[model samples]
Target: MNERRKLLLHEKVEVRQLEEGLGGSWHPGIVIGVSESCRKVRYDELLCDTGKSKLIESIPVTGAIEGLYQRPFVKSNYRGRIRPRPPSPEHFDVKTSLSFGVCVDVLFKEAWWEGVIFDYNEGGDERCVFFPDEGDERKFKLTDIRATLEWDEFSGHWRERGVWTLVSLAKEHKKEGHIFQLVKRIWSRLKVHYGFMKMISEWTCGAYCLW
Candidate 1:
């Protein structure tokens, strides 16, 4: 039997982004794994708008702005503060006495919003169903709900809060202009270019090491 190697795992941390010796941004991240050398750490990277978790490594722990996982806000230029995606099943508690067709308040940015149970699954918790929209009532995992909202009739927002406004959305569909199409082309090219660079980086490192 072999003894396990020691690893430094950070529960909550902020990763600072530095580019071109100019701009800097902080991103929420958690150290999930450590490299065999103990020189690098693999972490759950949280992105703005959509809470996308991506693994980033081969960097020193000093690169991260140490902090708590409680920081859920990601600064954005277009939408200001975009809430990151909810934590995985590990971090959420999904027990509820509320039943199907019951009105509930969904959690968003520390506030409760309207949400309705679409369908109750046989398996409770982590599999609770919520249908906030009518025509597009989609069944979601129990972990998706923020919390159950209590009925308040006296509030002025009874009608508005009774149902989620974001679900029943109204928007105009305008044809994409030439600028939009051009932006898409540039974006695709940038992706290919960055991907090529990443491939080269991995290949260069792999060539120098035998392990």
Candidate 2:
């Protein structure tokens, strides 16, 4: 919170901005300048600014020192709203250890690439042991490793038009005695009668099964 008051020009920070006639959310931007007259700040976008320096505190993080907030409190008992917690490196680290071999997207030189975490480096910095699709094996810092939802999974889960079922769908997918049953029944008998099957194939264009 005190560091928020001491925000310097050109300092990069993730800030919350509420816009007029629009929604509010957190965004990453550089602090272009600070208002000398007031506690406002000038950052990206026309109207986004920092709030009261003293009040712009993060939710208390365990082991975090007082007077500064890097992340917001995830739960608010008084407001009765569960605030989303910012992504933590510790969570990712634990996930890497628990869920090894899971596909992950790693950021390298500003570009995201598909990879898997096989191991971790035994160093002061938490570097990931990554195997990329390009056949390059290397260790990366946590800041450079990010996990994004798989595109196919995201589409299937969100659009509901894909092959995978993402949610608890109550509606049954199969119905008894559907129209195609008649076609299947006929085709089964026809194939058994070789002469009839030959004649039918010659008579009709072709047999096609509907999904």
Candidate 3:
């Protein structure tokens, strides 16, 4: 099996004004790595995460080298305390869920293993020949991917919502078994359902709805 080599490049990031009351001022830092799915950019020169940090800051990625290995996708972590409910207590309180969305442009390369082609002989003896899998050869093109983040204060949790888009040349040519559009639709439904459930549970205090 042949392994593909990943490329790396060094880059710098500068943060301007982020938002009011969000904490922290504009700062500069370094971007160490880029993966097929995520970008790892860190900054400590300005101590933005410090308790005293306030105000919003935007980090600009420019003049960055091309073909850097991106970071892997990881689930966002949420930590909060949930208020306990008293059994046989007073009236219930209505809760509302908070959510935000952001759009991003990502470029990554992914490879899949396709099946091999076999050749057989007409005689009693069978000969098998394997051809390089064409299904695995592809460059996924994604644009204007929208990602959302939702926080359930009542449940003390946060979740992500969105269906990422990917364009596959092999799928367009009908050489691959799966269609990119179909896959994206299915994924979208799943994300939407999960997000809705999270909101409903928080609002109704774990009430189940039919339909």
The lDDT of each candidate is 0.34, 0.33, 0.27
For candidate 1, write residues 124-182 as lDDT tens digits.
66433332221123344454464432211112011111322211121122233343233
Higher-TM-score candidate of 1 and 2: 2
Better of 2 and 3 by lDDT: 2
TM-score of structure candidate 2 = 0.26
The alpha-carbon root-mean-square deviation between model 1 and the true structure, to one decimal in Å, is 18.6
- Model 3 clashes, total count: 14
Candidate 2 residue lDDT tens string, 27-57: 3445444444222233333332354332232
Q: Is candidate 2 or 3 superior in TM-score?
A: 2
Error of 1 at 181 (Å): 41
Off by over 4 Å in 3: 1-8, 21-26, 48-211
Question: Which run of 10 residues does model 1 get worst, by summed lDDT?
Answer: 75-84
> lDDT, candidate 3, residue 105?
15
In candidate 1, stretches whose alpha carbon ends up further than 4 angstroms from where it belongs are 1-96, 106-113, 125-134, 150-211
Q: For candidate 3, lDDT tens digit of each residue in 1-211?
A: 1122211234443332234422112243444655543335445444445556432333222211222244323223321111111111123222311111111111121111111112212132322221111112122222211122233332323344222111222234455444434434433453357764454311112122311
**Candidate 1 vs candidate 3: which has greater lDDT?**
1
**Model 3 compared with the native: what TM-score?**
0.19
